[model samples]
Target: LLDGVRGWLMAGAEPLQRLAAMPTQLWRDVSESTRSRSDLENEIALLDQENLLLKGQMQTFWSLQEENRRLRAALNAAQPLEQDLLLAEAIPVKGDARRQFVLVNRGSRDGVFVGQAALVAEGLLGQVLHVGPRTAEILLLSDDTHAVPVRIARTGQRAIAQGTGNGERMEILYLPSNADVKEGDVLVTSGLGGIFPPGYPVATVSAIAEAAGGDFARVSARPLAPVDDVREVLLLWMRDTVSADLPKTDHAP
Candidate 1:
C-alpha cells in the first residue's frame, strides 16, 4: 500500500510542474494578437480622416474655378462702355414647373425695373418682372405667359414667339400654313414690339404643323438663348423715352 501511494504522489507533481510552465507561452501569444488588432484599428481610422479631408479640398477647388470663370466673362462683356449698361451677377434660381426665373444683383435703384429686358451670355433671357432695391427678378424666355416678337431670320417673316412652359418649346401664331418657314429655321428678334433689340437671336423652329382647319401653322420653337445655364446677365441702358416708359412701375418707393 505504501509503495502504491508514493507512485500516485509523483504522478500528481509531474502534471503540476508542466501546468506552471504553460502560462508564460499562452500570455505571449495573447499580447501579440492584441498588438496586431490595435495597429489595424489605428490604420482604418487614419484612412477615414484622410478621405474626409480630400473631399473638402476638392469642393473648395471647384468653387474657386467657377467663380474665376464668371468674373472673367463679366470683365469681357463689361468692356462695351455703354453709359447705362449694368452688369449683375445671378444669385439664385427660382425653379417653377411652368416658368423659369432668376434673381440678379441689381434692382430699381440701379435702373433695373419691371419690363426692362435682360440678356444672358448666349442671348435674350426675358424682361424684368419684379425689381427690388438690391435684387431683381428676371422672367426667362421659357415662361408660358411671356411672348416676344420674332422674325424668321432667313425670310424676314414676322411672328410672335410665345413660351410653352417646357424646355425648348414655344408657339408662333400668325405664320401662314405655306409660309417659307420650315423645320430647322432660325428666329430672331424683329424689334417690332420695341422690347428686344433688332439683331439678337430668339429661337429656332423645331417643328411645323397645321392645326385642324386653321389658317395658321402651329409652329414649335426651340430657344437659342441660354435660359437654364445662366450665371450672369447684361441689362441694357435705355436712352429712348419709349423704353423708359415701358417699365411696369414708375415709383421706386
Candidate 2:
C-alpha cells in the first residue's frame, strides 16, 4: 500500500515540474519573435535612407542641366554682338546682399574694363565696378547707387530706372505722372549714356502709383536679370574696342 502511494505522489510532481517550465519556454519564443521584428525594422530604415539619397542626387542632376542650358544660351547671344566678350563665372561676395556686388573671374588681363556692361542671355546684369589682376567686382543693377537709362519698348519713352538694392525690383525715377507707361511694359536700355548697349532688356513695369499732388509717378518694376541664380555672364568689350580705336597722343612736359 505504501509503494502505491509513493507512485501516485511521483506522478503529481511530474506535472508540477512541466508547469514551472512553461513560463520560461514562452519567454524564449517571445524573445525570438521580437528579434525578427527588430531586424525587419532596421532593414526598412536603411532602405528609406537610400531612397532619400537617390532623390537628392536626381535634384542635383536637374539643377546642373538647367545651368548648362543657360550657359549655352548666353554664349549664343554674345556671338551677335560686334564687340568681343569674355566669359566669366559669377562669384558671390560676402555682404553682397547689402552692397549688391558680385565678383567675376575676369579682370584687366582679360580685357575687362571698369564700366563695361555685364550681360546674360535674358538681359543686362551690371557694370564692372572694380578690377583686380585676376578678378573684378560687378556693381549689380540692383545696387541702390546704380542707375540705368531705360526706355519704354512700346512707345520709346525714356526714363532712368534706379536700383533699390533689391534683387527683384527697380524704380523708375522722375517719371511724369501722365507718362505713357503701363504695367507689363518692357523697359530696355536707351543707349543714351553709352554705358549699356541699346535695346537690351532691363526691367518690366510692375506697378505705378501716383504721388499725391505731384508731377512724378512712383513706378516700380522687376529686373529681367536677377543674378542670384545665374552661373555665368558675358562681359561686353565694346568699351575696350572703342578705347583701342582712339588715337594715343604723347604728352609734353
Candidate 3:
C-alpha cells in the first residue's frame, strides 16, 4: 500500500509541473510575436513618409518645365533679331519690393546700353537706366516717374500710361470723359515714342472712374509683365532704322 501511494503522488506531481511550464512557454511565444508586429509597423511608416517627399519633388519639377516651355514660345513669337537678342538673368534690387526696379546680368560690355528696351516672356519690363561692365539697372513700369505711350488696340485711340508706384497697376491720365477706352481693352506701344517697340503688349485696362464734374476720366490698368516675379529678360538692340526715328528724349517721362 505504501508503494502504491508513493507512485500515485509522483505521477500527480509530474502533471502539475508540466502545467506550470506550459504557461511560461505560452507567454514567451506571445511576446515574440508582438515584437515582430511592432517592427513591421515601423517599417511601413517610414516607407510612407518617403513616398510623400518624392511626390512633392515631382510636382516642383513639372512646374519648372511648364514655365520654360512658355518662355520659349514667347521668345519665338517676338521674333527679336538674332544679333540684337541678349538673354539676361535677372538680379533682384534691394528695397524695391514695389517692383519699381530690377537689375540684369548684361551691360555695356555685352552690347547693352542705356535706354535699351528690356522684355520678358509676357511683355516689356522697362528701359535700361544704368549700365555697368557686367550689370545693368532697369526702371520698371510701376515707377511713378515712368510713362509709356500706349494706344487702344481696338480704336487706335492714343493715351499715356503712367506708373502709379504700385506693382499691380498703372494709370492713364488726361483721357476725355467720353473717350472710347473701356475696361478689358488691350494697350500696346503706339510707336509714337521710340523707347518701346511698336505693337508690343504693355497693359490691359482694369477700371475706369469718371467724376460727375471732372473733365478727365480716371483710368487704371494692370501691367502685362511680371515685374515682381520675372527671372529672365530679353535685351533687344533696336534696329538702325528704329533708332534713328527716335526723338532726342529717351522716354516720355
Candidate closest to the true structure, highest lDDT: 2
> All candidates: CA RMSD in angstroms?
10.8, 11.5, 9.8
Off by over 4 Å in 3: 1-72, 75-83, 97-99, 241-253
lDDT of 1 by residue, 118-168 (tens): 876555678899999879998888898889998898999988999877757
Question: How many backbone overlaps does candidate 2 show?
Answer: 0
TM-score of each prediction: 0.61, 0.65, 0.64
lDDT of 3 at 82: 31
Considering every candidate listed, which one attains the maximal TM-score? 2
Reference-based lDDT, each prediction: 0.75, 0.80, 0.78
Say which prediction, candidate 1 or candidate 3, comes out ahead on TM-score: 3
Q: Which residue pairs of candidate 1 clash?
A: none
lDDT of 1: 0.75
Candidate 3, residues 1-253: lDDT per residue as tens digits?
Answer: 9999999999989989889898898888888889899999899999899999988998998987965675575565443543245577887667665547788887766766788888887877888899997898889888897899988888888888899888799998767778898899988877686777777788999998865778778899999989779788877666673344323332211
TM-score of decoy 3: 0.64
Higher-ranked by lDDT: 1 or 3: 3
In terms of lDDT, the poorest run of 10 residues in model 2 is 244-253
Expressed as tens digits, the lDDT of each residue in 189-214 for candidate 2 is 88888888788888999998877888
Poorly placed runs, candidate 1 (over 4 Å): 1-84, 241-253
